[model samples]
Target: MEQFEAFLAAHLPSAASFHPHYETSLHQMLLGGGKRFRPALLLGVVQAYNTLLVPSAYHAALAIELLHTYSLIHDDLPAMDNADLRRGMPTLHKMYNEVSAILAGDALNTYAFEVLSNAPFSDKVIVKLVRSLAHNGGVEGMVLGQAIDCHFENQRLELEQVKMLHIHKTGKLIAASLQMGAYIVGRDDLAQQLYDFGIDLGLLFQIQDDILDVTQDETQAGKTTNNDEAKNSFVTLLGYERAMDEANALAEKVTRQMMSFDENLQRELSPTLTQYINRHKD
Candidate 1:
């Protein structure tokens, strides 16, 4: 874990040059940290197929993590979710101020693509990486999902609507992580299965998050909890029991897909994935 954290820190942009404060704001937010789940997932997918880790693999993983961090930073803004905490610390906006947080998010979001484009990989692989990321993180995916969330905030949503929202906001990036890994390794068959697997895994993750919001502590979650009651969420639409049931079922179903892969891969990835699903922030 320390090695991985160091690996990412080494690749992350330095808080230097023209806008000193903007760079500092982004560094603080990105460096403040979370589970680094997306990057680890990307590495996991790569490991499942390749015997050796390529240098580009780490770069690709860092890019996804940067994008994820960008979303979290902005999500905590007053204009967005108005979150006060993130990763168990005062939010970027709260620590740095609103303008810095917004600029930091924007910088990280764009810098993610820059990292992807500049990664030390073949042109073909680079193209695939950029295309896969843009499709998943762009208007049709995460962005669209966030739009739905903002539009439907504080309103009761149908079950399908809630599912769609989570899929776009969380699932797309998870799926993209898998896809990016496959692109890096030049593997297509496993990529397709892993992509599908990631979608189910992501859905389970979001449901678990909703469950945590109701059942977990804000301190443990490192962010606001119980926001689902005031926003469009699966728990609000499906109720606690049913939402939990769905999360369990999805985890089981996705884990079953592991049969298509080796026992070793399944054995290593399944427990971590399940732990994430079953987690209670409290």
Candidate 2:
């Protein structure tokens, strides 16, 4: 993890353009630091299979983080969640301006693909990695989910429908993260299984976020809280207690799924995945 952080710092995207604060605004959110959950999942999978590939895996991990940070930037915009804080700091739109936030997000979004294209991996693997990230993060996946969530604002969706919303919006990218790691390590056989597990894990993550959005304050959440009143969140539909029940059920299922992985992969994912799977309990 420490090595990955150092790699991230060393490889921090430099706008390098004449626009002065553009670069600063771009770097601040990425550097502000969230959980780095997706990157660790990808790198952890790679490490379980090939330690030597770990360094090369950093590119993919950074790519995921970049894309995710871009999403957060856009999500916090006035046109979206209208959030003021993220990563325990002022949101990009709040810290700078909406235009800066939008442009910065766009830059990071494209740069993520560029980073993946230049990754120090085989051409075939890089292609697979790029496709995974793009498909999951593109208009059809996370973007679609975001669209659904936004379009359905103030409208309550059925339980299964809400699950589908999150699966596309939040689950696909996470599943892709694990799938990308499998590609990097030549564990194609495990790709589908990992992706399936990641989907459930991602759903758990989103539910937890919804619960935290209500239960915690802005300070405790390190971001805007109680901000989903108009959104079709699980906590809103299921109630806090029911949401906790759902999380507990998913946590148990995810833990059982983790046991089914090969011992080394299980060991690799245990630290990060287990920590997150059970985070709602905290």
Candidate 3:
């Protein structure tokens, strides 16, 4: 983790033009500190499969982090969530300007592919990595989910439709994170299983976030809270108690799936997975 952090610090996205705050804004949220959950998932898989490749896998991990950060930056925009806080700090649009925040997000989004391209791997492997990230983070996955989410605000959705919205918006990229790690280590066979687990995990994560949005304060949650009142969030549709039940059930499913993995994979991922698999209770 220390090594990955150092790599991230050294490889932060930068623009060559002499735009005053452009470069600064590009690096701010990345440096501000996030859960780094996606990166951890990728690296943990690589370590489990082949520790020798862990160092090389850092590039993939970093790419995912860059992409995830870009999404967060955009998600906090006034036109989106209208959030004022993120990562325990003022949101980009709040601290600087919405234009700065948007451009920075674009830069980070493109830079994620650039970073992945530079990773020390064969061209074929790089192509696979690129496809996984782009497919999940792009229009077919997260963007589609966001579009549905925003378009459906203030309008109630059926429970299954709500799950579908979150599965596309939040679940796909997370599923890709685990799959990308499988690609890194040439474990395509396990990728599907891991991805399926990650999707459930991601749903649990969103439900938990919805719960936290209403339950935790700004100081405790480190970001805006109670901001989903107008959205078709799980809490809004299922109510808080039902949402908790769903999270608990998903957590149990994730645990069972994790235990069913190859012994070595389970052992390697336990350190990271344990911390997050049941985070709703936290």
Candidate 4:
């Protein structure tokens, strides 16, 4: 966690620079706090590939974080999820106003590329990272998921459609982060395996989130609870028990995939995966 903190600090824009006010609110919103799950996932992938090159892993990890932060900022906007609290703090829009939130999200989105360009790796690795981030973070991935989510809100959606929504909105970026770590270590096979693992892991994460929203407290969830029934969500279509069963099955599959790796990597990720699955707002 200290390493993750250092990575965030290293990539954060300094306050001493001009235009600080413009960037300040959004930066503070980001720095306020979250679980930092994405960066840790990237780091885990790197560790699995090989324990060397921790600094490169940190850079890639930071890039994933930036992209994630961007998504959160935009997701909280009035036109989107209209979220008020995020990660237990006032959202970017609530803290800095909608325009500032939009700009902040835009800045973070672009900065992710900048961070990738600055990574202490070969140009080949940098290019691969850039391409993967763009593909996963752009229209083909998160953006498409958001579009689908908005389009289906207040409308009934099939289970497959809901799964597709999560795959685009959440799974793609998770897979990309793991793949980036693999690229850094030159392990294509591990990258592919990790990518597949991430897809299942991400879907499980989303379903668990849906479960929490229905069963947990807003404070623990860091946002509004029971919003899924209002918006199109897997829980709405599949019901709570079925969603739980699916999430558990998916988690088991993810754990099985992790087990295929050496014991060390599986052990490292076990706590991470368990915490996510069992997290509660009670």
Candidate 5:
């Protein structure tokens, strides 16, 4: 994680020369600090396959983090979730202006591809990574999920429908993160298994997020609480206890699947995956 941070600190565009405010906004949001869950998942998969991190893997990790940060910025805009806080700080649109926030997000989104395209991997590997990321982060994945979410505002979604929404919105990119890692290490054979694990992990993560929205305060959650009141969420649709049960069930299933992997792989990944699942418990 420190290495990933250092890599981003060095590579992130400097706001000093051009649009310092815009660049600073980007840096603030990107460096504001979250769990770095997505990149960790990517790097963890690579480390599991090969005991060391590769240059291409680091590039891929940065790409994922950039894309994730972009999503957060946009998701907080007035036109979207109208969120005011992220990572326990004022959101981009709130800190800077909406225009800055939007342009910064756009820059991050495009720059992610640039980083991936210029990775130190072979052309074939880079192409696969780019394709996976585009598919997962673009219309076929997160965007589709966001569209569904916005379209269904104030409309109740069934449990299965909610699962589908999250699978696209929150799960696909996460699944792609694991898949990208497997590709980096030439472990495409593990792609399906890793993606499946990511599905459960993503769902668990979202469910816990939902739980936190209702239970934790801003200080503990590091973001606005009760923000999902108007949105379709696990806690909103299923009630607190049922949502928690679902999360626990998913966690159990994911843990079992992780155990099915080689012991070394399980040891490498369980800690990070466990922290993701148990975050709400804190």
Candidate 6:
């Protein structure tokens, strides 16, 4: 994780030369502490296959993190969720201004693709990385899910509808993270399996998040709690107990699926998934 942070610091656009406030806002948000789950997933897949880190893998990981950061920024915008806090701090727009926040998000989004395209890999690999990211993070994936979420605001959404929305919004990039790692290591055989696992993992993560929003305090969570009651969340639809049960079930399923891999790989990957699940159980 430290290595990945160093890589980002070295490659990410410097805030030193740009509009001081704008660049500083971007730097603070991008470098802010959080679970680097997406990049970990990508790197875990590569380690499972090759047991070694690759330069292109680092680039891909950075790109995914940058993209994820951009999503968080935009999600908190006044036009979106209107969130005033993120990672326990004032959101970018709240800290600076709306226009600066928007431009920072835009810069991160474009820079992600730029990093991926210039990764030290074959053209075929680079193309695959770009396409996978675009497909999962673009119109058909996260964006579509966000659109649906905003469209259905204040309206009751059915179970399946909520699943579809989250699968696209939160799950696709996660699944793509695993797939991207598989591509980096040329593990085509494991791509589909990793993606399948990612779907369950992503849902589990989100469900736990929903549960925590109601169960934990703002200080403990490092973000606002009880904010999803008005949204189409599992806790809102299924109630807290049922949602927790669902999360536990998904965690069991993910563990079982991980066991399908080689013993060594399973051992290597299980801890990260386990920690992710256990972190929100309170």
TM-scores for candidates 1 onward, in order: 0.93, 0.98, 0.98, 0.94, 0.96, 0.95
Model 4's C-alpha root-mean-square deviation from the true structure amounts to: 1.9
State model 5's lDDT: 0.87
Best by lDDT: 2
Clashes of 1: 0
CA lDDT of each prediction against the hidden true structure: 0.80, 0.93, 0.91, 0.80, 0.87, 0.84
**Considering summed lDDT, which 10 consecutive residues are worst modelled in model 4?**
273-282
Per-residue CA lDDT of model 3 for 56-128, tens digit only, reads 9999999999989999999999999999999899999999999999998998999999999999999999999
Better of 1 and 2 by TM-score: 2
Per-residue C-alpha lDDT of model 2 across residues 209-259, encoded as one tens digit per residue: 998888799889999999999999999999999999999999999999999
RMSD of 1: 1.9
Instruction: Using TM-score, rank the candidates from best to worst.
Output: 2, 3, 5, 6, 4, 1
Residue pairs in collision within model 2: none
- What does candidate 2 score on TM? 0.98
- List candidate 6 stretches off by more than 4 Å: 15-18
lDDT of 6 at 75: 90
lDDT value, residue 141 of candidate 2? 89
Candidate 2, 1: how far from true, in Å? 1.1
- lDDT, candidate 4, 160-211, per-residue tens: 8889999999989988877887888888767788888888878877887888
Query: Which ranges in model 3 have alpha carbons more than 4 Å from their true place?
Result: none
Give model 3's TM-score versus the native structure.
Answer: 0.98
lDDT of 4 at 129: 86
**lDDT tens readout by residue for model 5, 41-159:** 89888887775655458899999999999998999899889988999899988987899999999999999999998898899999999999999999899999999998898999999
Residues 61-81, candidate 6, lDDT per residue (tens digit)? 989988999999999898878
